[model samples]
Target: MNESNLGRREVLDEVELKKLNNIRQKKLNQMDSFEELSYEQIMKMANMHNEILNNIHMSRGDVYLYSENEKLELVEDLYNTYMSDFRDITLKQVVDFSKNVAGVEKSQDLLIYDWEKMYIDQANQILFDSSDIGDLNMSLDKLVGDVKSDNRKMFKTPILLYIETLKESSFYWASVEEGGSGLGFSLLKKRSPYFMSNKKGKKNWKNVAIADAQGMTTGMLGVAAYGAWGVMFGPAGFALTGGAFVWVAVESAMASALFG
Candidate 1:
């Protein structure tokens, strides 16, 4: 292995390299699924408006008829679903650029697997008794159908659609009180490779890290912008922020798409 001024390379044993290779292969498979699945298909599976709204409520810890444990579990399930989709969408793009555009294989992969069906099942089971959150079950069932169906072709490359899902899913993940902070940070760090590898994204991941940190600052500012209005104007401010869960997601989604 050779080291460059860009970053030091650590030599890995054959076993380590093989494990990493396997992980990258899995990412390729997930990416294949992501490309086949269209934005319209995902939308048809679930109502984005409601998903956004419900996520806001979940973030505020205001979900009804569910215990803290259940809320945590449900939100985790949703988070995994979004991340699975994200890895397929984002990492796939990175890998493709490496192989096709750059004539190189970056050899990147995520520890996550595409368990879309498992996520749907867990969500349904968690919300089985409640009618309110259960409304989301329709979307979940739709997603299950999309996952199970052999024919999935909604659009060629609806880049923004997956971004929307990623943002919304992260919102839900950040809603849970237990591991919200950790999950959010993990997501941002793990996803840095997309920017590091893609032509549109940052070439230097260190810069991506800096941008992500700054994004957190701006994200808080976005929260304050909405929060300040809510403090003075009441319902109208709440309307803009959508009940406390609308912090910086729009920016994050835009940033992800542009950087990816």
Candidate 2:
């Protein structure tokens, strides 16, 4: 071959070598992405597993086993248990749970408030108007009275609200059960696919908030007001009633001032 041909061959060889190296590097990176956990990460995972097992045992009246061997075995068992029931837990629950575990508070509340504002702005879309409002209001009032009479009632008494809370707790516990060492990627992966997509997550939360707020504003408001009324008239009825009236009046005035 001529010198020129040899030079060209050399250049082509160099290019091919560089391309091969790039391909190998890409493969190595992909492998590393799925690599086994580091010692420190493993230890953290073990600790979390132990904590979850301990909590579960405590709640179930079972003896707390602290031995490293026993804890690891228990964690593995829990992981298996969760995997078995994975289908039972909905994607929506996973998303809600993921948000809660991330310390996103009043997530539902913000959505509800926004939805309420939306409804007020578009009054034509109002499903139940002032006519059926009385019955709805009365029912809510009774509910509020029942809850107030039993102070043990939680703020998340509504079915949907309670489900949302459950979803949050489930996601949190599921992450701990899994070999995740407080890593966002693992937790996010375990979350609902709907939640993983930002668009769907926002939309789902907004819809839930809108529905919840509608019920609360119409039916729930009556219950809350009735509860407040009961409290006002409980024992120190005169002072409480006067204070309650003033408070309601002030709230109405402020709301009118801000939005009306």
Candidate 3:
């Protein structure tokens, strides 16, 4: 080609370079705007509540049954006492009572997954615009974490608590068989306070279990909040220190509401 033609081609190449740069800059600006949106706070609160439910179920057995026909009429009075004396207490109160009754001196240990590590790794990938494969894997990891955490903390122990409450009530009384195939029912005589005391101990254990589950579920909320923010704003926004600070604040609020 002639020198003039070569010079024209070079100029056109420079114009294309400028256009590419402008496009890149525009995309970066859009990303920045997207990152500014925040909503992790709400998700954090939900997760905390889930934790409380899980803890309660873990500590308490599934159910308590009483049958006069089965020579277990004592359970009837216990159920009545629980209903009448303890029904109005909060979950925390119930848990505290159980702990005292059981003489439980230490907190139960719990196993927790490191969801923040996974989230951080994913955030790095999202910021870099890495392969879609990588993003998908990270998303999957987060979702699995959320599901497992939630399942671990649901209200699985309330039925048992309800049964125990009934067993502690005074309404359940013993009965005696009389003449003409008649059965005379009456309360047990010489009731022991130790029996009542032991019942309280069992209730305490159930309460601790509930508390632990609550804590775990609350932690999950933190994970979920981070995930939601990362997904909605893209990794870059979530990676920002400001985003993390906001997440922490939200998490703290949720924990307080659910477990404090």
Best by TM-score: 1
Q: Which segments of model 1 are wrong by more than 4 Å?
A: 1-23, 26-35, 45-60, 63-160, 166-260
Task: Give all TM-scores, in the order shown.
Answer: 0.22, 0.18, 0.17
CA lDDT of every candidate: 0.31, 0.29, 0.27
lDDT of 2 by residue, 130-213 (tens): 123233334434433443354332332222222222222222222233322222223234446756456443233323323323
Off by over 4 Å in 3: 1-198, 226-260
Error of 2 at 154 (Å): 21
lDDT value, residue 55 of candidate 2: 48
Where in model 2 is the C-alpha error above 4 Å? Answer: 1-77, 85-100, 109-159, 163-260
lDDT of 3: 0.27
Rank order (by lDDT, best first): 1, 2, 3
Prediction 2 global C-alpha lDDT: 0.29
Show pairs that collide, candidate 1: none
- Which of the two candidates, 1 or 2, achieves a greater TM-score against the reference? 1
For 1-260, candidate 1 gives per-residue lDDT tens digits of 11111111233446654664465455445443332334454343223433433444446433334543553353344434454544322332322211121111111111123342234234334333223322433554554445445343322112222223423333333313322223333333355566424542212322332232223222322222221111221222112323222223323322222232
Give the backbone clash total of model 2. Answer: 3
lDDT of 3 by residue, 85-179 (tens): 43432333322222221221111111123433333333333323322323433553454355335443222121111112111110111112211
Compared with the true structure, model 1 gives a TM-score of: 0.22
**Alpha carbon deviation, residue 59, candidate 1 (Å):** 11
Candidate 3 C-alpha error for residue 152, in Å: 17
